[model samples]
Target: MYIDGKWKAGNSDFAVTNPATGEVIGRVPDANEHDIEAAVAAADIAFADWKKTTAYQRSELLYRAWELMVRQKSQLAELMTREQGKPLKASLNEVQYGADFLLWFAEEAKRMYGQIIPSARENQRFLVHKSPVGVVGAITPWNYPISMITRKLAPALAAGCTVILKPAESTPLCARAMMEIFDEAGFPPGVINLLTVQNPSRVGEVFCTDPRVRKLTFTGSTQVGKELNGLAATNMKRVSMELGGHAPAIVFPDADPVHAAKGLSLVKFLNTGQACISPNRIFVHEDHAEPFIQELTSRASRLKAGNGLENGIGIGPLINELAVGKVDGQVKDAISRGAKVHTGGQRLTEKGLSGGYFYAPTVLSGVTEPMRIYREETFGPIAPVITYRSEKDVIAMANDTEYGLAAYIYSNDIGTAMRAFEALDFGIIGINDINPTSAAAPFGGLKNSGLGREGAQEGIEEYLETKLGGFAI
Candidate 1:
């Protein structure tokens, strides 16, 4: 753990394993309540000075950190691959994605401007100022470990808030490596702190109940995000949540099924379909469903699953045995409910993959609304296809779920695309674009998916407060 500008160890430690091999890769400190208290205190103390620094100073430090990340990109990518069980190429991409946040926020720090308001009273002038919200408590998940942390931390630091990070227990090594860069970049003591613990509830209680932490940011499931949001409400701490997504991809009759299948296939199994934004339910026009299924099945069957470090490996193991079970259970439930598996559907237990948590990339057709896979967020490489007769029916089906994070539409007609985009309840709508999010865009959900936004100008605003001042001229 890195706290108060120093490296500290707890009395006990927990082992971090490689999901690809089910082997212990390293051990990280398991923090206690005292460690949490110290981290919060350190951040609170540092906030007084850190928040007062000029934006230029903060920008320079962040730029230095980004430069360092680029310098050691290969090393960081290798570590992520070993610990997180992602393909080395994917890990390298994640490193670059994470580093972009720091680089983007570095330039954004100088853009925090407040406007002057005209007063109704003749003798008074009204002024508005944006100030840092003070100490921040951030909790990030295991998927996209490096990028998730940097996404929350970059905006917080850019807004001049000192933060105490609680990274997922399964991926602390990546968090620690990030802290090393921040330390080397000359961030003052307590400006950024990281705590690793087996039980997140304990540290979460401190962040929610403590008076020092002024804001809380989290990237995880909606259930957990709601729990934390409720706890933070007691102290009225500001919050930014990027939660669960059960995205749907709709294929319109105007579009070619083959083209749509290729696009969806590329993004559906990204990170082995572990991402929250991965398209869960695919709706296709009945006229084109057969061709779409055929192409998707062929592509899924061709994917090579193995150790991420190996050459020509496109898929890696699931994060753990539990993840494997969840995906398997979903596929079985869909099959039991009358869904047909067009291609791969079972766990891979071949000679080389016997010890790891691997699941075959699967494609299912005839998926109905009654099945578990249709409603639930299947965080795996299972694409369940449902047929739609008309645009109205498909839109209704897509908007039926509680999640409204992201949705995709494939259509050659601009009118149809515009109508669907405006009618869909989701925050992000991709019309023929599979990869919709970037550091330059606003990313979040509309309803149960999440609260608040990340990236672009809105991201930094989450960590700041608007203050109004009245003065006599």
Candidate 2:
């Protein structure tokens, strides 16, 4: 772990294992409360100087970090694949995605402008300025480790705030690799610090409640995000959370089944469906539901699941046995509730693959609202297609879950797509397009999904505080 501008280890250590092989690949320091305090103190000290640095200087530094990341992309991607169990291609894409944020924010850093406000008094001039929200506590998840960290870190750094990052214990290697890139980019000591620990609750409490941490950014479950939101309230720290999602992809009758099928297949199975934006629920128009299911099932059945680092493999194992068990339990509950298993509903137990936490891409049809797969987030490569007759019914079904992170609609008709987009209750919506959220757009959720945003202009604002200045002209 890197803390206080240097690489240091705590007295205690935690093991980082490969989910595929169950082998301990590396050991991370178990940062205790004292370590957290030191890190926050270091950030507090660094923020004074870092915030004073010109935006151009910060942009240049971030660009340098971006260049370094591109130079080390393969190594970083392999590390991500080894720890997170995402396919090498996906891992490479994650690295590139993460680096894109740095580059994008580098440019955005130069564009952080405050607006002039008209004053009621003739002699008075008013201005609204955006300033750094002091030190930030960034908590990221294990899935898409590199990308998540950059999503928070890039904007926070670009906003001129020092960051104390706490990555998931399951996958700390990617975080460490990023820290190395930052160091190579010559960021000042204490500008960014990383602490790896098994106890997220304790770390979160210390970070969120600390006065030194003026902002809190997290990406994980809704339950945890709520806790952080309450804790951060103690000091009234700015909080930004990108939480869970049970995203829905609605396919209309007039849409291209083949194209929608391919798009849905990728969205449903990306990173073995560990992604928060992964489409878990599918609402298919009754007229085209059967054919869509057939095409989807065929594409899913053809996916090759093996080592992520291996060539030609489409999918990889879950992060651990626990994840596999959670997925299995959900599938079982759905099946018990009268859901039909279309294909690949069992765990993979073949010779070498038996050692790894592998599950075949699953498709569940005949799913109703009461089924576990319908209401809860499966968070696996389990695609559940629910048939609907009318647009109103499908829209209601899509917005049925407590989660409203993202929703997808497939339709050729512009008016139909617009109606679905307006009716669907989600922060991010896609209209006949599989890719909705981008590095240049705001990414977040509604309701229990999460608070705040992660990309584009909104991302930088999450790490900043607005202040009004008034003067007599």
Question: What lDDT is reached at residue 382 by model 2?
Answer: 94
Please give the distance, in angstroms, between residue 11's alpha carbon in candidate 2 and its true position after superposition: 0.6
Off by over 4 Å in 2: none
> What is the RMSD of candidate 1?
0.8
Question: Stretches of candidate 1 above 4 Å error?
Answer: none
**What is the clash count for each candidate, in the order shown?**
0, 0
TM-score of 1: 0.99
lDDT of 2 by residue, 1-473 (tens): 89877999899998998887778889989998888888988899998899999999999999999999999999999998889888999989889999999999999999889989898899999999989988999999998899888899999999999999999989988899899999989999999999999888888988777778888888998888998898888778888888989999998988987789889998899999998889989888878878889999999999999878888889899988888998999889889989998899999978578878999999888888887778788789999988989988888888888999998888999999898888888999988777786789999999999989889998898888889999897
lDDT of 2: 0.89
Candidate 1 displacement at residue 457 in angstroms: 0.3
Q: What clash count does candidate 2 reach?
A: 0
Clashes of 1: 0
TM, every model? 0.99, 0.98
